[model samples]
Target: MAETSPIAIICGGGPFPFSVADAALRTGRKVHLMPIEGWADRDRVAAYPHDWVPVGQYGRMVRVARNAGARDIVFIGTLVRPSLKDIRLDWKTIKILPRIYRAFRGGDDHLLRNIGKIFEDDGFRMLGAHEVAPEILAPAGDAGRVRPSAQDIVDAKLGLAVLDAMGPFDVGQAVVVTDNVVLAVEAAEGTDRMLQRIAALRRDGRIKVSAGRGVLVKAAKPTQDRRFDLPSIGPTTIANVKEAGLAGIAVRAGEVIVAEFTAVTEAADTANLFVTGLAPSSPP
Candidate 1:
């Protein structure tokens, strides 16, 4: 008797999906991938047993996963919101459009929870990246020589307060703070662009600091659906933080995903930047 593979991957944006696949493979499951078109890397996803589906083809995604012999499904990476007009939804998917549209009108958490329900109703359990790769959750200590100063810690708490307030609106998960002032808040542009804004502000002298005491704080929103869109950071985030002249980064402990954990920590150590996973603080 042959045992079924425990999981199939529904891959979207970023390197985390690939990391999920890697982790699943390490655990001896035959990790099949359902790569969403426009969001997943076809060349990379093709390395696994896969079916490529368009982002809006919810019906096809489930059928393919069932066909792949996956008992449970793992979802990893980002899916950018597309204009409704751009989606060429199939008949089965079109029927569910109203629900999706309403979800979108509400917030990201609502949209994703609805999407997860769609998969579950089709008999697949969608697991978080953290569940897929618990080893990749960033550990709860500074990962480099540079540690957040007392002021940086205060600023991180402040940023976390802001993130919590904005989370219910499905706004963003990150904020940059320095010298007890917020340098930037993540918006629709995401973390990278938000950090770039800080860099730009410094370049244009909008921020007074010549060097960098920037601390980036990333965490789950107050209403975050942890099973799907848990916050993540990796080597790229470290590089970007360095480029933005940020001294360190803090994330919600046991909630944030750290893709390429070893490489991210090594890079942070090399750059003398700190990455810490801490419990969220109350708004003070």
Candidate 2:
């Protein structure tokens, strides 16, 4: 696609959708923001050329994007898996009910790929957020003043191994490890909630490890479709890690999206937490 062509962003909750929109705009592309009704922030969406879309209005989504002269579409931000009843299906979605049912029979990755295929069949190209905004990807080495301790590195590697082992099962993209002990794995609740679980455990004394002793590791699943659902972190992640009593956060370099890089780094520095991007070879 030409750099000057208009791009469509199907936004979810959080700041990532705006971040990607900004990046695309910087590259001289016109952007049409389609914010998901319940998930996306209204004030932010109002700043762009946008239409509010509900979860199951696939037909309207396509029509709106086409009207806006957008051929490339990117999906970003946080959206919990909605049940069928939660979807307000229009005729287009109702016609594809069987496909949607089949898609939901598998894991998140499966559902996303099937959804993307539906769009692709409609002649719209699905793109990853990182593709439109390469600058949002995490880089190798530390992102803040702090660096991981030697033991922290070991824990991070173990966390990555755990994720890799769970990848084929489409389990989750993040884990917490302290002193080689697995504290938690991200599941339907997501990364933030998983970290919250760790924080609760520490508070209840179930996790005896000292503060600043563990690592929070996030990465893409081994067979993940990178076109959507890549792991992402931001300043909020730093806050969560600090609350979870972790030594640092480690994510796959160039694979995980770093939202609000400057704010994230500043948060990490202020909290005295390390945020490092691990190279592919760093994991076992």
Candidate 3:
């Protein structure tokens, strides 16, 4: 029984990881949550029923899971890019590092895939965030009250197309688009900063791009793995959207995570920004 199998949670930072732990507990599963040393939100994780461990203790995680008779593990929460200087690489990670580097350099997906391989090779299964926290996964159609207008629809298509091209490259998760013109592509600066940059560009009158009075589409890369670092939007996102003078927000249907759905919608309504999820089949 999957439900009875001890579940190991590799937790990083943020509230979402705790939410997932709650979901697992609700399913009557025994959870062992390993919190990353520096990045893991300890206070939040401590509130949940779990056993915490330092980050990069791959061997310990493996051993803990094995001891608990765990066959399934889920990685949740936000992972920051840590320097090599900060890592506490266990024997397992040390042995796998070179192979992980060869896969696609030192990115989240690269490391995760390699780690997943480790589990699979050991006859354990790696589960995605959606499996444990189905409630946060993006739903069909729009999420908030404001649906995409005609122009918003067009912008969504352009954003998705660009995302399709860039996702495999793994530069970032979000892009800011208006009227089918790419305003800004999210890089190391992050989504909220990227939106701020777009707003600055408009304020300076540097670009004459017209995406209408307010409309921006944020979508996840198609190649993105849901196990770690899924594109998430929350109250801060809605606040930033409002600050950016964006009319509507669009994310790929069943792709992005609405971390704070109720608050996001409430903020969107208050800001008069349309918030909707777009199906890949929807017209531009």
Candidate 4:
């Protein structure tokens, strides 16, 4: 008898999904990917030497994983608004109708927990995105070419405090701050949109101006389930910060993922934006 290949399901939503697939391959684990609609890069995903599935075909998604012999399934990526209005939901998805409906009324954490439960019940154990590609999980302190300023430290502490309050509920992952004041907290609008909000607030003087000392603190909610949506940063993050005139970024170590570190770090260096990874003040 031959030994079976270790397999893991990759539910990809963004660039990190592809990066996770790359890491899984290097580990000799066959990756089964289910790419999310409107957000994933299908071409890149297909090139990665992994099995691929559609965005919302939940039933087929399970079948593919099982066929690929995956016993340890891991999810990574962002889920966009469920296309409830035009969804061709599969039986697997339909089975979770009640929870799905509730999620529409509920906020981010509510939906993620419910989805996590559904996967758990279906015999697929989900792990955080960090588990597969831990290298991208930025370490504490500086990464390259820049260090956090005094105001960046102040904003990070303030942002972490705010997230600590909301972590238990998993409502948000990133906060935009200037000086010691929070300009915006991420909601359904996401990081880029949230930064846009911060930009608006700065324009109107709702918070301190963002010429300097403005940083984005990205975090995982206290109750953050590892499988579905872990906090992430990448080249896009740097681009957004540059556009918003933010000075730096801070995220919790081991709780966040970066898509392509070289490109992201290079962009950050170009913008002179410091990127630091932090740990919870105390264990959750």
Candidate 5:
């Protein structure tokens, strides 16, 4: 039934939104994109049937999706949480202001889950990008020509442990570790900026570890709603890891999203950095 019905995709920044759309199309599902203004790539969205939506225009989004005969919705790509005052609320959003205010009081996972519930209450099914395109999920083992060393694998395990421990706090998903020492943890700054911070630290001689000694490990929160905000990696992530002087990158296999898999692999190879997907139970 879903295969025949059009799917509504709420796009954010980066290439994942288009990647999901392409994958859905290949499976014979029609897609109507609702690109969030300011965040989504305008040029890329022009290639598909898309409607431009502002951050707080919930009513407009629903009408557009319903008009396109879409019942399933997928939220993909990156978006920094917006301040409530910054949102230009439509009547529908304004009507639900109390709920929205409460949602904003918590962390990102809490906020997204609540907002998704709002849409669900209004008659729509929320789906993860991975559900629409399983091919985008990271596979087990090495993802490039370079392989992680024993030390790198150990560090990845430690990084995963840190993320798992921090999951309940609703903190960020990615972390950098070297020689069992936690170098950095992703917070409100997001992964790329976090990596840039590490790079800056290295440049200032704060981190004495030689280049290519640490690992960047990413995974979803343990109790996170998979329908939204699954951890993701792309070629840009590879570039950031390299700049941070990391030897490789590791993510939970079949759990994290891998955008542009071919390009990610090529970037990893070209950078001489390992990009491996660790099994749910163990590091790869």
Candidate 6:
């Protein structure tokens, strides 16, 4: 019965692709994977019906999705931007160089939305990973055993406000706060690096902020493309939060992907860290 629903997945990198595939399979949905070579987890992707393709091979991706009879396609995980010199463009891809070049210069959102337009032009509806794996989505509150303190809650709200303001610039999805003071905002450096900066500040004592004095809040940017760039958190993120001495982690409810929810929460429990799913915010 569930086998009747077939979807194509365009995966980039990380545990998310596997997580999505696993959840989809359990519901009896057939998953056709088109993973970027080198970036994708080869062994994990192999467990499902998969085709390996290079990041720049847009033409091949479309053909594979079409062959899979995919009416709907979902893109997941992180794709590290490759150097210009590293790309190997096919003739089909080269023909679209003008659009691709503009996308490349305009930043990730531009690049992704352009890619989305191409896929849409090819007649495939783009779907969010949550549509395929609802279990991966963050629940409405107190996601882990520990709960955020009142101050932590305040910081979380402020972080969201700041994050909202930053969105239009395509700034970032996550922000760090301490006693209502903004510590860091995720940029091109990514969440991990942003958190590491906070950790470094703690070590430097130049900021006079101590460890465990802050909150880490992540949510989708107001203008974020939901089909991709859904904020994700996992065991590694939990470990980073713990190491950063952040009081807790907060993400928008129903929007974030809490990868390996059980494992992440259990780890949060062990680390005495709180993980909460707050309501999503609208743009300012």
Top of the candidates by lDDT: 5
Instruction: Score every model by TM-score.
Output: 0.93, 0.98, 0.87, 0.88, 0.98, 0.94
Clashes of each: 0, 0, 3, 1, 0, 1
| Candidate 4 runs further than 4 Å off | 1-4, 8-10, 49-55, 102-105, 201-210, 282-284
Instruction: Kindly list the per-residue Cα lDDT of model 5 for residues 132-193, writing each as its tens digit.
Output: 99999999999889999999999999999999999999999999999999999999999999
RMSD (Cα, Å) of candidate 5? 1.2
Clashes of 5: 0
Each model's lDDT comes to 0.81, 0.93, 0.74, 0.74, 0.94, 0.84
Question: What is the per-residue lDDT of model 3 for residues 1-284, given as tens digits with 9 covering 90 to 100?
Answer: 55667788888776677777778888888788777777677777777555566665667888888877788888877776656556688888788766645643555666677767777887889898778878887677766666677877787788778878887877677777776668788887878888888778878887666533545566666666666677878888888877777777788777777776787888888777877877767654
Clashes counted in candidate 1 amount to 0
Off by over 4 Å in 6: 1-5, 281-284
Error of 3 at 92 (Å): 3.5
For residues 1-284, what per-residue lDDT tens digits would candidate 2 score against the true structure? Answer: 65799999999999999999999999899999999999999988999999999999999999999999999999898999999999999999899989999999999999999999999999999999989998989998999999999998899889899999999999999999998899999999999999999999999999988898999999999899998899999888989999999999989898899989999999999999999989987745
Task: Name the candidate, 4 or 5, with the larger lDDT value.
Answer: 5
Q: Model 6 over residues 1-284: C-alpha lDDT tens digits?
A: 35456788998888998888888888877889999888888888878898998978888887898888878888998888787678888887888878877778865777788878777877888888987888898987887778888898888889889988887887778999889899888988999888888778777885686666789899887787887778889999988888788888988888789888899989999999999988655322
lDDT of 6: 0.84
Instruction: Put down candidate 4 lDDT per residue, 136-251, tens digits, no spaces.
Output: 67777677699987767878888888988987765779887777777788887899888777667667876656375687988777776666677888888888887777888988
Candidate 5 accuracy as lDDT? 0.94
lDDT of 1: 0.81
Q: Residue 105 error for model 4, in Å?
A: 4.8
* Runs in model 2 lying further than 4 Å from the true structure: none
